[model samples]
Each structure stands twice: as C-alpha cells, then as structure tokens.
Target: MRIGLFVACITDSLYPATARATVRVLERLGHTVVYPAAQTCCGQVHYTSGYRREAASLAGRFADVFSGCELVVTPSASCAAMVRTGYPRLAAREPRAADAPRVLELSEFLVDVAGVTDVGAHFPHRVTYHPTCHALRSLDVGDRPLRLLRAVRGLELAELPAADECCGFGTTFAWKNADTSVAIVADKIRHIGATGADVVCALDDACLTQIDGALSRLRGGVRALHLAEILAAGDPAGDR
Candidate 1:
C-alpha cells in the first residue's frame, strides 16, 4: 500500500524524529511511505480554539494534499482524531469533508489496516503507556497500542495507575486553564511515578510533552517516548 504520511504540525516542528521513526517502521514492513510536504496543521488547534473558518480552510488543504493517496497515516493520535472526527464538523460545507474518513492514527493503521501488531521493535526498558484522551475516547484505539507494545522483544509493559485519565494537554485547555491543567497533570505524574516505569509511551506527542515536562520539573527519572520511536528502537538504520 502507498501510505501518505501526514506529519502533523507539532511532529513536523518539535518532534521530527517521531515522524522519521514512523517512516522507518512502515518501510521495514514493506509498505511504501510517502511524505506529503504540502501537508500542514490539521486545523485541530484552530477548530478546538473556535476558529472555525481558519480550521475549515486548513481541513480543505489537508484533504487536497493527500487526495491521491490510498491511505493516510499519522503518528500523532490527536491530529488523526482531528482529521477523522473534527474535520467533518469543521469542513461540513467543503467538498473535502469525505476525506476525513481516510485519515488513521498510527496504531489504528498499523494494527487494523496493516494487520500487524509486532513491528520488530526491541526496547529493554520498563515502559508505561498513557492513552491520550483523543486516542482513547475519540479515536477509540483501545488495546491496539498495547498489543503492539506487548509484541516488542525486550519491552516490559507496566500497567499505569489510572491509565485512562487525561494528561491535561487539551491543546488550548492548558493555556486557558493553567491551574486545572497543572493539577490534573500532577495527578497523572503521581500515577506514572507509582508505575515505576523508566519510560512513558503514547501515540500523541502533545500528551507526552505535558507528561514529560512535569517529569522534568519534578526531577523524576521517567522519560517520555513516542510509540513510533519505541517501535523503531532496534532498527540499525533508523534514527535513535
């Protein structure tokens, strides 16, 4: 399958390695991955922030950029959720509204579409997964990530306490409600600490950033790793 990689704005700018890792994993599986350079923000930020007109414009751009691909995949679950769930609402009047259904989260595409759980990854560290709100509730990517993690050669998957709770990175929610965001994230950090995992893994970089920042401020040893990075761990040719 020719997979068009939708590198979300955050991943494209802040976490390019995550995007690279995603490509490596997909290529290793014999699928051709194409990066649509014209792709930009999925308008998730705009849509969630109530800039409906701007969000709709970007949604149309997204649809146009990947219109030729058979399937579109992105490493960030939040962006995938936005394109799949939010685009329909934001671009209701646009002709590209039908494009929303073609976008898939990394885990969803890997486990469901590609029909592969084990991506031949090896990471010999204790890791706990944080199911970001979008991936958990919006995308409903239940257990797909876990199944992939479980198949890793040397990974020790620890159960995170209160695993389903939000990490408090609800896009603009963090800035608008700083105190509440901090408190919620504090609880998430406490639960992560309880897990005794050295690394926290998730499909969403936004959530990982929030958790990772708290871990750094608290001087905790836990570090955040995107699932794609973990899956690309053992690839000799892939970026570390």
Candidate 2:
C-alpha cells in the first residue's frame, strides 16, 4: 500500500518529529510512504479567517498536488477536516477542484483503511489522550486513537477528565480571543493535572502546543505527545 504523507503546515514547521513518526509507523506496517514536495498549507486558516479567494486558490493547489496519490494521510485532524469538508465548499465553482483527493487523519487511515490497530509499538509510559475539537466533532475519529494506544505493549492508558472539552486552541481563536482562550485552557490544564499521567497525547499539533505550553509554564511535568509518536515508539524508554 502506497501512502502520501500530507505534513500540514504546523506539523511540518514545528512538529517535524510527528511527520517522521508517521512515516516510521506506516513503513513499519510495510506501507510505502511518498512525500510530495509541492505540498503546502491546506488554506484552512485562510478559509476560516474569511479569505475565500486566497483559500480557494490554495484549495486548487492542494487538489493539484495529491489528486493522483493512492491515499493521503495526515497527522493533523483539523487539516484533514479542511481537505475533506472545507475544500469542496471553497472550490465549488471549479468542478475539477471540487473533486480533491481523499484525505484521512492518521488514526482513521490505520483503523479504517489499513484495518490494523496494533502496529507493534512499545512505549512504557502512563498516558492520557486529549481528543482535539476537529478530531472529536469535525472528524469524529472516535475511539480509533484510544484503540491504538490500548494496543501499545507497555503503555498504560488513563482516561482524561472532561476528555471532550476543547483545549482552547480553536485555530485563530487562541489569538483573537486571547483572554477567553487562556481561561478555557486553564480549566483544561487543571483537568489534565488530575489525570496524573506522565504524558498527554492528541492528534493535532495545534492543541498539543496549546496544552503543552500551559503545562510547561507551570512546570506541570506532563509532556504533550502526538498519537503518531506514540504509535511509532519502539524504545522502552521512549523518546523524551
């Protein structure tokens, strides 16, 4: 099975390790991974920010790049949501653009497409998962991530308190409504602290950055990790 990795902007720039982990997990499962160098932002920010024309242009670009790939996989749930949902609306006037290639979030691709849950990963850590807004409501990835985590050899999966609550990243909402964003994440941080897990994991880097930053400021000791990173883990000690 050949897979094309859509390393979304945030993941490509700030969380390259997540991209690499994604490749590692897929290759470990015996799938070939291809990276399209022409790939760029999915225009989610532009569309969500109300720049329809610019967003449409980017949507067309995205369609051009990955339309021929066997399958597109991304680590970011929000980006997948944008390509799957947002792109069609943005490219409605352009018939060709509306037929953009199918894209799946990593968890969905692994569970639904590949039909495999246990990828033979080993990670010795007490971990809790924070399902991002796009992953939970937008993408509705459900228990796929948890299923993979539960299969990890040495990982102890702890249930997160108020697990469905948004981490307050909300894409541009984090900056546009700074005070409200901080307040929401403060509550999220408190709930995470109660879990007593060594690490918190999520599908989107945006949410992880939000939760991880808050945890770091207070030296909360709980590290934020991406789902792919955990699934890619082979070391008993794991990557710190």
What is the C-alpha local distance difference test score of each model? 0.89, 0.90
Q: Where is model 1 more than 4 Å wrong at Cα?
A: none
- Give me the candidate number with maximum lDDT: 2
> What is the C-alpha lDDT profile of model 1 across 202-240, one tens digit per residue?
998888888899999988788899999999989997635
Q: Give, for candidate 2, the lowest lDDT window spanning 10 residues.
A: 231-240
Residue range 1-240, candidate 2, lDDT tens digits: 988899989898999999989998898888999999999999999889999888888888888888779689999999999988887787675555586788999999999999999998988999999999999998999999999999998999989999999999898999999999999999999998898899999999999999999999989689999999999888443354
Question: lDDT for model 1, on a 0 to 1 scale?
Answer: 0.89
Q: Each candidate's TM vs. the true structure? A: 0.97, 0.96
lDDT of 2 at 129: 96
Q: Cα-based RMSD of the predictions, in order?
A: 1.2, 1.5
